[model samples]
Target: MRPFLLLLSLAFSGLLAAAEVTLTNGEWPPYLGQQLPHYGVASRIVAEAFALEGVEVHWEFYPWARALQMAERGQRVGTAVWTHSPEREQRFFISEPVVESAYHFFHRKDRAFDWQRLDDLRGLRICGTLGYNYGEPFQQAERDKRLQVRRLPSDELCFRQLLAGRIDVFPMDKVVGFAMLHEHFSAADRAQLSVHPRALRSDPLHLLLSREVPGNAELMVRFNHGLAQLRDSGKVAQYLLDAQQPLSLAP
Candidate 1:
């Protein structure tokens, strides 16, 4: 390698490091949130992936629905950590999964509860969070009058209802649920909650770049490339571990 060639490569890397991008985000604790370390796990992954491509990420936090809308309307570049659906696929260029997560029903330990299927939830009061899809099977059951679910504004409210005996069960991402409880509840309050053993559903979350934003198609390509590198190096798993640690903080 010639000295000139090495210098050119170094110069190019510097230029890439100077590039920046902004995206919309929302609260989904221990994963994506404004308050957590590195703004939570998923946020750190998304930021690091872009940084690998020399693109800095500036996040605009909002309600989950508004985050989607701002990105869908191209008011921002895109949004992070959304599950794919046919409607979303039509409007956005989806990146490879940033993280895989599963949801489980959280209940009060005082109340005996067990379920092999959604049908088992027949007479129980189920709490649903707004702007979330519990998947088609759960939805269909709710529509058919087999499951009773009441929608709420956030996971915090759902948990509050559960403690108050206003709701029998609430489905939440396993990590997010525990993370929220750990952050906001007392030891006694935490003791009162227990997650069901069976998972409700699992989904691979993604970064969505709206078609309305020019140059985003190519940006998606660059992002996926960076994400592949991140995964291959095993930092994705390490980041998740770090994000969950008791005193996880920005390094």
Candidate 2:
């Protein structure tokens, strides 16, 4: 009887001491969030991949900027669906890209305008979520004062602002915009919005580790191995295909 109790105590202690990965997940639908369960393909894929290596993940959801801040502050270990920009590259270690995201402009169809280049955006109000970088063109426009940009707290807010005609254009990742529009927008709202034929930029999405996280190299290595296993097993492609189904983010 005493032996049985001692063994149980040891097991519980081990459980309590397990190496846990605390992750910061934001409410980016079809990528990471509670609003759409299976839609978090990247998050779920990473979680599943890491589990194969005996690593456990615990997630806390926050606004996108806050999630990035938590990870940077070491209050959280990592973030997903992150763009690997040079500025951010210096701030964090990045995993190999898990997916690619293209940037597109969402605008009201009846109010069409020829947005040929960054210079063409002069005097237009553009909407974007805080902490998101949609490549160089828009950034350049921002620097030149050619474009008026509003930083929303989330994608849902951007959609709402766009629907209300408060902003001239909403610049978002093609996949993310599509997912959000399908998940949140009403049929009427959908009718008003359309994607620009011209792409602003296309870049790969990476899993980012905060500078404060310990064992960065080892964590990245392990994740690479796990991701390789998933790719070899045909799981990654399947996840991407599965998450392609449309959802709305209309406010």
Candidate 3:
């Protein structure tokens, strides 16, 4: 009787655990909005999609690095808008990509930068987000003194500084650049800045779940399933299409 009772208690506990999951998010605009009513684009999408599956999500908005660490430590159940790489793949289970983005350079329209290659950025001050990864070439350039990368706390700060001539160029995802331009910059500022024709890389964005969440690997599967349904039903693409304005895709 004692063993039977213990098994019953464990079953109930597992049920309770499966019913609750907290999602952590960083301040990536249009994807995750820190100051908005709802977390933002990705958060809203994931929330509504998971609701269809009866999975409840608690959204916790935090800085990018903190959110990443929380997801890694299992304190936070999940993170959205994460790029897939070998290192990250080992640490967490990744949901199917809900969005795609291009990393590009934003320069003053009046200035002609000889940015033929990553090495061409030498001696020119380039602004970038602290936690953003711009692929191998730029990272190597930073190491070899071929680029001077200044770390800013956020995209808004980076672009504002760039406009003031405090930084020569700012690197950011083009979607983010368009959002920030509309949110923080005046019409005049928008006219002054232009995204470079060259793209650093195209990345598929995913929801990252820490290994600590109970059955997290399974949860990733569920998330991806919902994402697929949303895409098939035309919800996901419509969200992105709505956000894509004045932000043209690369030909």
Question: How many clashes (backbone N, Cα, C below 3 Å) per candidate?
Answer: 0, 11, 0
Ranking by lDDT: 1, 3, 2
On lDDT, the candidate that comes out on top is 1
Q: Clashes in model 1: which pairs?
A: none
Provide the TM-score for each candidate, comma-separated: 0.88, 0.78, 0.82
Tens-place lDDT per residue, model 2, 1-251, is 99999999999977754466988887766777866665388888878767766678777878777888888887778888687778887778888878877788888877876778787887888898887777766777676777788888888898898888999898787777887677667778888888887888888788887888777667877787888898899989988887874443333
Task: List the global CA lDDT of all models.
Answer: 0.88, 0.79, 0.79
Clashes of 3: 0
Write the residue-wise lDDT of candidate 3 on 49-163 in tens digits.
Answer: 7765658888887877888899899888888878898898888998777788788888887788657777677788899887667888788887787788888877889988888
Q: How far in Å is the alpha carbon of 217 misplaced in model 1?
A: 1.4
Consecutive 10-residue window with the lowest summed lDDT within model 3: 242-251
Winner on TM-score between 1 and 2 is 1
